[model samples]
Target: MAANGKSRNLESFVKQQLEGAQKRFGDLEQEAGKVFRTLKARSKGQAREVEKLLGQINSDALLENPKVKEFGRKATQVSTDLRKRLDGLQTKAVEAVGVASQAQVKELNRELSRLSKKLDQLLPASVKKVTSRGSRVSAS
Candidate 1:
């Protein structure tokens, strides 16, 4: 009976632990989402700024000089390459966030499963203890 009571207590404890873990996972997921959104906005703004700079340079007197023209072309190409790299990085960041989110979820599930199994091992003895005592007590 004492063992049975112990099992119930352990079960209740495990349930609380699982709930806490789930809440933590939710908070982490929300934070990750916010970070992803911020990165996306910043990338877009940066791309726009680069485009504006390139446009201004192209319209300037430097474009009329042969030597300057070559330099300007090279600069534009570099800018384009940088923009492409940024885009690739942004895509990778998104993918990383997704993978991290999945990993977190999996971690939470594994924790819950482990706690549940531990509770299962302890519950029978707790129930037996409670029954033998012949009195009801709050699990909390």
Candidate 2:
């Protein structure tokens, strides 16, 4: 009975920790998403402003300028790099929290089920019956 109570308490503690980790992971994901969206919006606004400035200038002259072309290339590269870094940060944060992905959880469940079935097949019916009944009887 004491062992059963201890097991139950342990299970409850583990469940609560898992829940908290999942919640924190979710919050991190949301924060990352918001930051990405904000970055995208700001980039778009800047792009529009650049276009407006180009319209105000001599388009043919500015477009032909090497510096202008270099600036555009650098801006694109920076944006791409920022996005990649943000994605990496999000992935690291999730991993740091020890939260399993859905696919990973499903695969783990499948493996556990397979192992349980194999165990059932190996164990004798009598042993299975006793073990199943024994725990509840002992708890009582």
Q: Best TM-score goes to which candidate? A: 2
Tell me which residue pairs clash in candidate 2. none
Whole-model Cα lDDT of every candidate shown, in order: 0.72, 0.78
Tens-place lDDT digits, model 1, residues 1-140: 46557758877976786676577657766887998899999999999998888787855675688997898789999999999997997567555434334676699679868876775676654442344566744453
Each prediction's TM-score against the native? 0.38, 0.57
Residue 86 displacement (Å), model 1? 18
Candidate 2 weakest ten by summed lDDT: 131-140
lDDT string for model 2 (30-82, tens) is: 88789889999999999999899878899888888999999989999999999
**Given candidate 1, what's the lDDT at residue 47?**
99
Off by over 4 Å in 2: 1-18, 33-52, 101-107, 122-140
Q: Best candidate per lDDT, number?
A: 2
lDDT of 2: 0.78
Q: What is the C-alpha RMSD of each candidate to the true structure, in Å?
A: 10.5, 6.0
